[model samples]
Target: MPIEHAMNTISERHRADILIIGGGAAGLLAALAARRKARERSIVDSDFRIVVLERNARPGAKIRISGGGKCNVTHDGAVGEMLVQGFFRKSEQRFLRPALYAFTNDDLRRMLRKRSVPTAVRDDGKVFPVSGRACDVLAAIEAELRDASVDVVTGTRVRSCLRQNGVFCIHTKMSDFFSSRLVLATGGVSYRHTGTTGDGLHIAASFGHDLVPSSPSLAPFFLRHPVAAALSGVALRDVQLSFRTPSETVSRKGDVLLTHKGLSGPACFSLSRDAADLMRRESGGEALVNFFPDFSAEDMQEMLLRHASAHGKQLIRKFLQLQSAIPSGMIPLVLKQAAIEGDIGWGSLTKNARCRLQRTLQSFSFGEVKAIPLDAGEVSAGGIALGQVNAKTMESRICRDLFLCGEILDYAGEVGGFNLQAAFSTGWLAGSSSASGSAGTGV
Candidate 1:
């Protein structure tokens, strides 16, 4: 309950060496890093002041809500995935490499260990904080800030910033503050209710930063099939998700969930970014997706032909008896859609019927992806263009003393744990770079 009531402080002005806006993962990390580097600095000292402003009552609220309420702090994979061939830009990915590898999943666990936060590693190598409590994640961050004596002011809504002389002046609903360097980690517009209301974009845009258009990522899909609606709650492990774009066909296998609306879970979350992008490009038009990708059309055809040849002496069910795990209810629909009549016995199945079944198994085309509701998303795809900022310092190229990180930057990833990793990495860079040798004297 760190969230304070909306009470204005009404102070004329405050001063700091580093000012960090937004206390989510990135902001908190920035404040902590500055304090560590500043060392023994007074909050009131003009030489070393570090302040963190958060609009929410408490920091890390979004981090608290991730992974079905189990905050996924970071991933165990190599840091290489953050850029270029890995998924993000080279500079943005490089910014994270230092802290990501420096701290690592083991380090996060060791820090959370004292709080009795248990951690577990999934088969894919994604690590959870182990406590299964978002508060543990928040507590770990809050503890760092408190230990460093970093000034954390909650419920402070920023209006704008003015750069005068070499310092930037910050105006907020609560009061005014000045800092030599400013970090904008206000995040993006994915979870509006959590206070990520695109506030940073306005402030950064006001300062002339090049921004890439943003759209919701890792969002759910909406389907037109009656069978989809019927199997809404069904979930399948080891299932594959294949996307068909005009130029290429991409497929990934993992866990897949059947939502009341359509498909989701790991497979869907992985494809969500590109799906939303293409879906928007088509202007509400549909995209084709396949639920089963491991078996090829040829493989399905061969299996069906062999089954009918031998089981032709048995009932339809007898033909599929070897694969009874597939729900009996879906068998008829799958066969019918493939143009294989329901009444035919396995022995009577013709070569033409087998080919149709091959099509169904190899490519069960699902309809277009519907509009993704912003609040339902985990992250957004676009943000401050990577080329416009100094990756080493996260300093804005257009606005001196201004830094951008977190979702405000174009570094995002899949559902498991990459988002938090981006937050920690960028926050660390902004903080250390802002506090390093010459930027500011005060903490």
Candidate 2:
């Protein structure tokens, strides 16, 4: 949507004690937190009005589509484990420490449970609704908001926000909103269809907060040479992916999905930010895939020699299909890449051929990354700089009553449930602090 100038003639006007923009994961939780904290403070509900302005027709559009419609609400674990295991950078870990601990994954789960939305934790630690429906999670949160008497106005596009005489004047397309405390949870630039188009970042910059120059994070890579159709849906488990950036080598280990375009899944998404950065910096950036991340070249050679000795008459392709971890569909491609014949017996393989095969297995070239579209990312990488925001309160240091939460902040977590957990945590802290009118006094 195009930005329009605030009109002199206001169609309508609304007032609230606390106003939250963008009713996404963060905004919805922020409204709930504010309501809960206000009650705890003995503030009369009728006297203090909390409002949420959402551009979409309904709230939590992104949430409904997350985790392939299952909605990975959060990662099930202690806050420390989540911080250490899910987030990669130390700076990000430090920034998220307080909020994540304050409103933990367990807390989130408990809230869902109360709303009659039972959850199940997968073996990989992803917490999802029992019914496997993302809409159920959104519905539960919406129910909480309704019960709390938090007014959520949908289809409201904010044109501009300005602080005038200790009041935040938010000019939307339909009406004007005024509030003392404002929460910007407009999310990031990714998932444009869901209404997260970096509006919050722009608003923050207007309020004197620096931005980190947005890029696509947790996105798939489109390769120059696409993979074969047979390998399109094949999944590689426990694989490592390495990409060379202008500054350093970025590597990640997890499961990878071979798409016809290139790669997807946890491992590829993890490296996407760096890969996108690398592509932006220069062309011809190549990714290397390590099918056997746990095995060294010598170990692989030794294993191959043992297999050959045991089954001398076994065809190389047949050995790879039955004995190796390489997928059946990928054997032909692997043989071709290694310059080996599929018909050749393992016993007849030359020493040079064995070494080539070992090398190929260790670092198979995934080809040059053609593109990593920023809009295609699950979450964006940049937003308001973290140092400008009070981590404990989720309030901006530059602007006192203005709080920023969710993907609007510069931290973008890995794929899974880390991002949503961060959103909930920060939103809770932001709402709680805004309601209490002081930092560290929030619930």
Candidate 3:
């Protein structure tokens, strides 16, 4: 359908029983879940209308661009496994327990499967559609919504939202909407081009909900000293990245990709939140990289000593490249940091040089980090404070009949389908609770 026609369809219908703002993952699922719940309760479609308002020309803009367009629907695991592997903080784990269990990854896959969108899980446990197209995932969701008789309004930007005499009023560029219940799923400020501009945050705050200060999470660093062009695309597996703050040292271990600007991949992204937070208070900081995260300093030293004694005639650079698994392009930089000559024979290595090399191998400095761009993050940290919303139902404690879900909440999970799962889980809970008109105890 044309964008103009979609907008026009909603113009005449300004009232809904459940109004959802932002047609991304959360909004789409919320609408569908509400309709499903309503049907299960024997509520007629005429008695309960669900409407979704989206700022973009179509819904699921972020969904279409996620996972390089393949769309990592959700991680492949049980609720407990996902909670343990995907979320780090205990608070987030506890708060998300009910919702995640209520709507598990299996449930999401089953829904897609029913829509004829078969999914496959990668070796690393990231699940994607078998066709490897993000549009297929979005199409499945759209199909479900259409079958449920849910109304979706696209290209309509919400100007403001407020509650008046128990009814929620939402003003948009196209028209005004009123609803008894509203779901705020506008997502975060990250990926502004995809229409997530933190509109929901403002709306939530206006209704007396507290907000956690927003920051960039799952973003790459911009180094003070950029990687060499030759080493730009080089990648390392099982590396540990650490950043030092005044209080303590934060670390993460995973695969890393050396970009032309600085560092990316799972390791860098995992530590980016801490790096970004630290850099926000301090001007800049350095990230230390341990290429051999599995080996201790003593283990590496013993191995290198044994190798040097056995291969006395071999050049240090050649030994590092062949045995240590260090990239050829990085040898020069590594040697320079250790203050050792790359061409020097292993037998000619002095005690001081060997020690320096060992230390460098254990904790090689990546570089001074200038900043972690907030806009470049896959998901932004912080949102409406978790305490302000009920964990079981995703309803706002401060505002009756107003529910919150998705990136609008203060929980930001790690990459590899965690964020999307949280969105889906929370949206499902919010939709079900709101449709049933049940109030949840705020935890």
Candidate 4:
């Protein structure tokens, strides 16, 4: 959507006690929490009004597309387990503990149940709606907004935000809105089509908040080798992915998909953020796949030697097909990589040739990774610096009456439902804290 200066010149002004920018999962939760907190402190029924401003035509675009439209609501686990399992930094895990404890995954399930959206936890610990529709999850939030009487403005992109005399004037393409308390849950730079284009980061930076440089997370890597491209669409279970850089090497084991460009899947995603960071600083790095993760090099050599002895008279190609657990299509590729002739007989195979075959089967190199596109990622790392925002309240330490939540902060989690859980917990804290602070002391 293009910003129109002419429209802003004649745009009408609306006022509210609390203003939330963005109508994503975090924004929706904040709006509800703020309303609830305000009512709790108020002596009168209509004490303060809360409003949500969304740039998109509708809210929760990200939610509707999450988990392949099923909407993984959150991960099912204890707070400590979630923090450690998803590979979140120790410092960030500690910072998020209060919010995670305050609004547990059980609390979220209960809240959704009250909204008529029953949820089920998957075997892998991912929580999803029983209906298997992300729209239902979004509908629940919309219902809460209506019940709380929160004003929602859609199709209005914020042009600028100015703070003067303790009031924030948010200028949009359609109009100008005023409020003392402002909550920014606009998300990160990824998924620009969903209205998370790093606007909040830019606006926050303009207001004197330092920004950590943004990069893509949870995205497939593009490799320098043609092997991944040739094996596109082939999937392997129980494989280990190793990312090797000059400084360090990281490995993860899970299911992986070979794409036209490179690698993707849960295992690859676990290494994406660190891979992106390394690829950004250095031009490239090596990615090696342990196709036979269950067996060591010595174990593989022993197994291969036994199989060769049993099928000494057979062709090497036929012997590998009959004795190996690898996929039929992958065997030819592996043989080619090992520089072994498929037509060669097992009886004629030399000791050195057999050793080469065993090593290649154990670990296949995918060459170097070239790049990871920032926009193609599921989440974007780097946003508002963590130190500038209070993890307890999600309020800005540098500015008054301002709260930050969701991907706008410099934190990213591994794929699954960790990111969504973080959004909900942080949003809950920011909303209630903003309302209580405004009503008691008046920011």
What TM-score do all the candidates reach, one by one? 0.87, 0.93, 0.94, 0.92
RMSD of 1: 5.0
Q: Whole-model lDDT for model 2 versus the true structure? A: 0.87
Q: Rank the candidates by TM-score, best first.
A: 3, 2, 4, 1
Flag regions of model 4 displaced more than 4 Å: 1-13, 43-45, 225-230, 314-325, 440-443
For candidate 3, give the lDDT of residue 45. 86
Across residues 1-443, which tens digit of lDDT does each residue of candidate 4 receive?
A: 22233333432336667889998888888888888888888624355778899999998899999999999989988988998986468877877888788678898899899999999998999999999999999998899889998889999888789787677778887667777789999998988989998889888988999998999888887887655346788876788888888887777888778888888888888878888888777767888778788898888889888978887888878866764446577778778878999998878899999998887776777788877788989889899998999988989998988999888888898887888888888888888888884442322
Please tell me which model should have the higher lDDT, number 3 or number 4: 3
**Worst-scoring 10-residue span by lDDT in model 4:** 1-10
Candidate 4 structure, TM-score to reference? 0.92
State the lDDT of candidate 3 residue by residue for 1-443, as single tens digits.
33333334554488788999989888888998898888888888877888999999999999999998999989998888999888888889998999998788999999999999999999999999999999999999999999999999898999898676566778897668877789999999998989988888888888888889899899998888888877888887787888765566778998778998998999889888888888888767888888788898889899889988999999988878884446777788889999999899999999889989998887888878878998999999999999888999998999889989999898888888999999999999888888884311110
Model 2, C-alpha of 442: deviation from truth (Å): 20
Query: Candidate 2 lDDT, tens digit per residue, 110-166?
Result: 999998999999998989999999999999998999999999999998888988656
Better of 2 and 4 by TM-score: 2
Which sections of candidate 2 miss by over 4 Å? 1-13, 245-247, 438-443
Please write out the lDDT profile of model 1 over residues 264-334, one tens digit for every residue. Answer: 78777777777666656655534333434556666666766776676677666545444533455456656
